[model samples]
Target chain A: MSSTPLPPAAELARANEELRHQLEEAHDLIHAIRTGAVDALAVQGTEGPRIFTLQGADQGYRTLIEQMNEGALLLSDDGTVLYCNACLAGLLQCDLSEVMGRAFADFVPPAFRDYWAGLLLKGWESKSKGELPLQTRGGALVPFSVSMNVLSFNETATLAVIVTDLSAQREITAIRAQVEEQNALLDRKNEELKREETARLAGERAAAEASRLLEGISQIAWTVDPSGANTYRNRRWYDYIGVAPGEGPSIGRAWRERLHPDDAPATLARWNESLRTGAPFEVECRIRNADGDYRWMLGRAQPSRNAQGEVLQWIGTYTDIHEHKLALERIDQGQRELLNYNEQLTRVNVDLDNFIYTASHDLKAPISNIEGLLDALLTELPAETVAREPVQPILHLMQDSVNRFKRTIELLTDVSKLQKEHGLPTEPVDLAAVVRDVRLDLEPLLQSTGAQLEVDVAAAPAVMFSEKNLRSVVFNLLSNALKYRAPGRQPQVHLRARPEGAGVVLEVQDNGLGLDAASEQKLFGMFQRFHDHVEGSGIGLYMVKKMVENAGGRISVSTNLGIGTTFSVLFNR
Target chain B: MPLQKLTCVLLVDDDQTTNYLNQLLINRLEITDKLLIALNGQEALDLVQAHCHEATPDCPALILLDVKMPVMDGFQFLEAYDKLPLPEKAAIIIVMLTTSLHPQDVDRVRRLNIGGFLNKPLTKEKLNDVLKNHFNRHLPE
Candidate 1:
């Protein structure tokens, strides 16, 4: 309001400097107010200059900032800490007075100094946040998230920084990471346990399947341990023994109680030997069945061995063989009886042969004696008595009777001799030669009967027979053919030999006074005569049959009445 | 040539008729001056014991034996004769005469100390053969 004079040059310069300094102070004051850095201000009033404060109006907000868990701070543009909350001081492990008016960068570790500087520079431009480790008063580094904001009150700038005390947060993060690792380990252990459980279950299933298979077999199958303790038995074993499931007797008791008394000892001995030697065992024994009857059984066992060639167990089976054994015993008994019968028959035959021989011998002596006596009488008789008609005829008749009797006795002797020759040694006899000899012997008879004799032995020439027997057979057959000739026709005879099955067949065919069926049946009987017209002792055919049969040959005669007769003899060699 | 006559000839058989016939044959042959007959081998053995106790002309020189008998057989007599105490018993000529040529009888006679065998119904030819073979003498034809 008052006028003033101009000052000099040096003095005016000094005055201008003072005024500029004052103007700068005024600007700072305005910026501090706008930025809310100053809580109170002093102003000129009407009466006097008065001081004013915003403490009452912002008390709740100020208290909230002081008690916040986050560390709060106000910093100058040059990184100097102008103000700090208690929480910030507590976070740094320092007093609030010590933290105030210090460079905020001083609390940052050396390794993070550049990052702090960068955060401050960015904070001046806009909002900025960063994570870094800050050194506490105790010299331990703690992780912190720093959030910075540039506060401007009409160009008066300050940095508002929120620092999270990351110690608790870092502990939480470490704890969480440890928990995740433990969970992963637990998962791996669980997977391994599942795989092991699957393998164990599979092994158990296989064991169960093997046991089921053993139960299905038909034979009385069983198993025993190396020590001969019975381990397992099939269902069939239980069924055959008439025992309930799981109720069978032990092996020792079974041998004593179930096996027949006579067989138990042998069965046990064999089993013991097999066990001791580790060899396969087999036995035939009688066992009492469910019906309390003893039956034959064939028991067999084979040792099961391991890789070391040591016996592990024995597998066994029992088979019934009762019926077969009984049948064999019966057959043995029958054979013994048959042999005894054969011996008795042989004895009887021998006795009969001896009797026949003795009788014939005795009979022959008497008959021959009679003939001799007759001869003596005839020799003594006078020639005149022999010439008398009736006396001569009677003498002739008597002589004929005596001759007949003698011949009969001689034939009987031959028959008895034939029985003795049954076992005589035989040789291959030429049938042709025998036939030739027989023909010569019968030559007179053949000529008298005018019988044509034909001989053909080309087919089968030899037979295994006694030579004497063969001669007798041929002679009898040939003579009969000539002797029994037809009265009206000349007798024709054919003698032939041929081969049969493993033998020779000789056939004598004759055209003679063939007999009827009735006469032919008795033709071969001793002392049998078919034709009254022919003179015969009737022993010729009988002797022939006997000789042929004794030499293991058979004679069969086929005849047509009054036409022809054929005699076939089959000789077995 | 006619053979020298024997001192004695014995005939044995179970049948009387057979013995008679054998005796006649020996007589007709003129082979022995003395002839004896027996019904069985036992009777013949008794006759032998009575006459042939010593080796002399009285002892039988020839014996015609029959096989079958009730008390004893020809074979039985032969066995007893072998044990006899008579001196020169081997000198006696024994000939078997039988109705049967049974192989058993013939074999038994041959095994014995017999000179020869003859079938039943004694004949001059048969006797001559026996006389010539055993006694070095034969009946004349």
Candidate 2:
């Protein structure tokens, strides 16, 4: 028994009016009972059954049932609608009589008749509740929640039911379900948006990193659109060219403007061809910087194409190759200078040979004339007529001078001949034959000197040399050996040839007055002789050396003073 | 002497001393009755012309020609003499006398129409050999 508190004055006045109307209706109901219109009042209470006079306060429970907001009804075990409140008739949209005798199951849709039956079976308990659609007067289905209980009225079993309209609850439940669905959809969309944002940020970061890497490289990087318009340049491009941002347009135009005039036309032609054909482009040209100095740059580019093979852009680089070009030019200049110097040296050598030739040729006549005069004088002035020839010794000395002079002239001629590279043809000469011939030629000298010549040409049989030059070389060496023999020792000469390394070595070993280290140093020089006592022009060994060198050979000497000397001639293959 | 007497001798040289010496040697040998001297190839040509123009010409039996002279050299004279008449130049013993026995000069002389090449100052023995080879006369030893 919880009592509601009094409302405000505005609601109290409405309540007082509603109570007066209810009293009038209650008065009319009492009047009807007194006139025998209303007979009895029956109620099924928690305590069981109760019957009361219509005039008593027990009738208020009937009134309360009729005035309740929920529909109230009672039914027989056979499913007949035995009793119903005004609210039940109103909720069904029908009169009270129309509801009173109809089957209770008739108000439920046919689809829910079995559910009503199941509810009725379970109505023996204190109460049972179920949801079902009820049929309205207009033949529409209205959803309701029904509570039913098995009760006894007037000593007979009946069912008491309470019905609640569930359309509003159903609508509210549908709205809540829609809100949950909307929330799920919103959350999914928000997640997708967040991922998209993150991907966009990552892509931007990657592009930035790629740009930074391109700028960090030393070479200038640039890009052009498919139309050959300059689209982008890396930071290094500005730094290298000393240009401000956005100054250049249409790389072709900028290149033509800054390119060395000598290189522009060709470079542009190649560039245009590449652009037209979408082919890779490469060229070396001088590019001028902001300081107006030109440096050689090697530019190369390749087109980026789409799947359809349409060119999208071009990526290119320019590399500085100035230093390398300059280095090559310097090397070329040096080679040219070296060739000129070689030519000049060759001319000088020819001039020297000519001078020697004329000088030696001119000196011979005077020497011969002096010798002839001396001979004539000696013959004409007979020893008996002289009595005492004082001029005779002077004449002999003069003859000796003429002879020496003649020998010097002959040596000069030989030297000049050796110096000329007149392509003298060589043959394989038998050293044995050469030695035998030289020995025979020196027979008179050998007999006079009483020298023993030992020949051993077995080691190396033949050598490649000019015949005339070999005869001269052998004659000079053998005569030297015979002339310069040790005072008390008979000249023992050994001429041998053998292969040493890649060349033939000829050794003329003699037991002669050997040379000292100091003499050996100047031994092969022009007019150099170790023993002045011997009759020599001091030019034999020098001629031999020149002859050997002219034939691309070398000569060396080994000697121990007062012991022996060996001259080795190495003829290269 | 291994050489016989000759009708006359011709000396062609650029140096007076060389000619004089050669003439003295010829006289000493007593090989020729007369000796004619010319300083160069041009003078020698004039002498030969003069001898040929004479009514009783004293044609030289031997002509000793020296090389390396002014006006005309030995090879140049030989080229010019090739154009001369056969009667004026034929049957004359021409010897090349040169101080330079350089192989190239000798090669030049070998290509010429000469009896021999003698290196100066020419010895009596060399001259005797030349006379025996060309004149069919041997010097008395």
DockQ scores of the candidates: 0.53, 0.40
Clashing pairs in 1: A34-A153, A35-A153
**Which digits, one per residue and each the tens of the lDDT, describe model 1 over residues A495-573?**
9899999899999999888889988899889899877887888888888888788777899999999898999999998
Question: Candidate 2, residues A441-483: lDDT per residue as tens digits?
Answer: 9999999988888777687746778878888888988898888
List lDDT for all candidates, in order: 0.79, 0.80
Per-candidate TM-scores read: 0.59, 0.56
Q: What is the interface RMSD of each candidate, in Å?
A: 1.3, 1.7
Best by lDDT: 2
Report lDDT (Cα) of residue B133, candidate 1: 85
Report model 2's TM-score to 2 decimal places. Answer: 0.56
